[model samples]
Target: MQVKIEKLDHFGRGITYVNQKICFVAKALPNEIVKIKVTKETKKYIEAEIEEWVTISSYRIPEVCPYAKICGGCDLEHLEYKKENEWKREKVKELLAKFSQIEKVEVKEIKYLSPYHYRNKVTLHGAKNRVGYYQPKSKNLVPIDTCLLLNQKINELLPKMKRLARENKVQEIMIRTSNDEKESLIKISGDKPKSLIDMKDITGIFFQEEQLQGKEEIISTIGKYQYYLSIESFFQVNQELTEMLYEEVLNEVKKVKPKKVLDLYCGTGTIGIYISSEAEEVIGIDSCSSSIKNANHNKKLNQVKNIQFINNKVENVIDQFQQDTDLIIVDPPRKGLDKKTLRHIIRIAPKYLIYISCDPVTLARDLKELKETYQTKIVTPFNMFPRTYHVECVSVLVHN
Candidate 1:
């Protein structure tokens, strides 16, 4: 059936009505007319694939990557980068008004840098002789030699890594590079490849529970702070934008002048440490032990004296810091805060709350609940994952 795409969804899929039900067409753009075949259907929505394009959007651009259509790593490669940034900001505003009931939202212009070769880490899966990213929503592997979204160092290492994956019969491989591009680490799920142990630029090679070569971590410098990242440590993918994101948080911390800061889902304690000088004391909590270990190492690496890292879930330890926490910053996973955690945060009701979110839908939903005890407004969008639907936001809320 032929349909004109009304707009793009949050996932970068085009939306139109089919049989009075919303249909999502993959790879279709706004104002584009396409012939679609229904791939799946349900009571709420329909999924379709574009069989033919009758009309094309002017905003669409030539994809720089050959595997853009098949690779699941990026979504908006067909859209112009300028338009992509605007759409991201509008999506954040739309979600906030729709889900959070914040109609007069003032979302700052989306911040971004170069759209290509920004990723510091990449994970590829191997099947038989093929090694590459999996197709979206499926386990099918698409053979890839290079990804435009990865750092140049990672793209250069792809050939060797692919060969190693094929020869060693490894099921998965994760490569991480430092921001300076001076250090690199590889983690594999199968046997340790002897060939990779002495690879140039490789500082570490981890196989399962053991380190095959070099040190256990690599150091990355973001802004003025340095962090040591282990194989299992969590760090932002975009190095430049991460510094900007943290700076945004630091600006808010400066305004609040929080005496005691509580950071939830702190990961490697980047945000807490970034704002430590402004606060009298800072406590960061995360359930990932490896992350906490890295966080403590980073604490000493930066010589930060006013911060402490705890290896525990925020929901479990939030109450302990309730009384003295002047500000609470949460950088939650894509699922956002659970009801239990939200309830506890509401009970604690710190003077200031800053939420850094990767998913706008979940962020808006949580902001709605947070509006009960906090004045929610002023969200700033960061193009953390350009060429993809993901957008990071920093929302500052003052206690009511």
Candidate 2:
């Protein structure tokens, strides 16, 4: 089948109509014609892989990764950075219009964080002979020597870690680096190593056994705040961008000036801790016990008395939230908020709601439902992950 690419989709895939239905073609560019073999067929849209490109966009550039087409880590690495950001803005507006019936949404151009070597965290899957990211949607591993998205320290550690994996009984390895580049942590997840392997520039080494025993942690600080990181807890991958992202949330808190705030899906209390001084009181909640523990530890580390961490799913513990909470900030996972949580939130109906979403599609979907009792205020997009299709947004929703 031949399809003329109209625009880039959220995943950086080309969008063009085929047979009176939309088709998403991978590795095709806008204003280009491509011969494609259908990879997937569904009622709504068809997915295809490019077989031959009759024409290509001028913005398409040389991909750094040899496995860029197959590896799922970096989706937009082939496109020029300038065009990539514009496509991201267009994608967000498109999703918002589709979900909220709101067109012409003002989407700020993503702040250009460094296009490469910005990622501070990377998780690689390991098999007997290969170790790298999973193939697009499969368990098969695509061997990778390096990823442009990772920082220099992580790239330096990759060879040694891969060598160790081949030598030891390794299932998975997670590498995390601090913004200062002074602190580095490596987590092994199949069989716990008896002792830390001596490596250059490593501050801490952690282990997590397959039987769910022998867990370890490392401490990392962002500016003045301290956060404990574990194999289980969630932490932002880009450190410098995270500070700006947190600042965005803090700015929202300042504008709302709510007396009390609820930070739902709060990971390690980073946002709550950052904005604790602004609000009279802040309550942070997450389902991960490890993250909540770290959050509480961070609360003590920061020595903020008004903030507290609750180790419970936000959806399950909505009734437990203090009635005095006039503000709510949600930093949910890629899946976004659930229906039950949304309903409970509507029942409580805080005066101001701030949503920090990595997935724009889910954010738009949730915002559509949130529009029931809330009015869309402002949405700002942050280029948290620069060379990828992922774009983060801070949306402020005001109570009606």
Best by TM-score: 1
Show pairs that collide, candidate 2.
none
Model 1: per-residue Cα lDDT at residue 163:
77
lDDT for 62 in candidate 1 is 92
lDDT of 1 by residue, 1-400 (tens): 9999999998999999987999999989999999999999988999999999999999989998999777867889999999999999999998899999865667999999989989999999888866899998799999899998899989988988877876787778899999988899898886566565456778888887788888888889988999988878899999778998899999999999989998899998888889999999999999999889989999999999999989988878776655567899999999999988998888887889999999999999999888868887689999999999999999999987
Error of 1 at 57 (Å): 0.9
lDDT at position 371, candidate 1: 81
Q: How well does model 1 score by local distance difference test?
A: 0.89
Please, what are the lDDT tens digits per residue for candidate 2 over residues 24-53? 987778998899999889999999988998
Cα lDDT for residue 95, candidate 2: 86
Model 1 misplacement above 4 A: 191-196
Off by over 4 Å in 2: 37-46, 69-72, 102-105, 191-196, 209-215
Itemize residue pairs with steric clashes in candidate 1: none
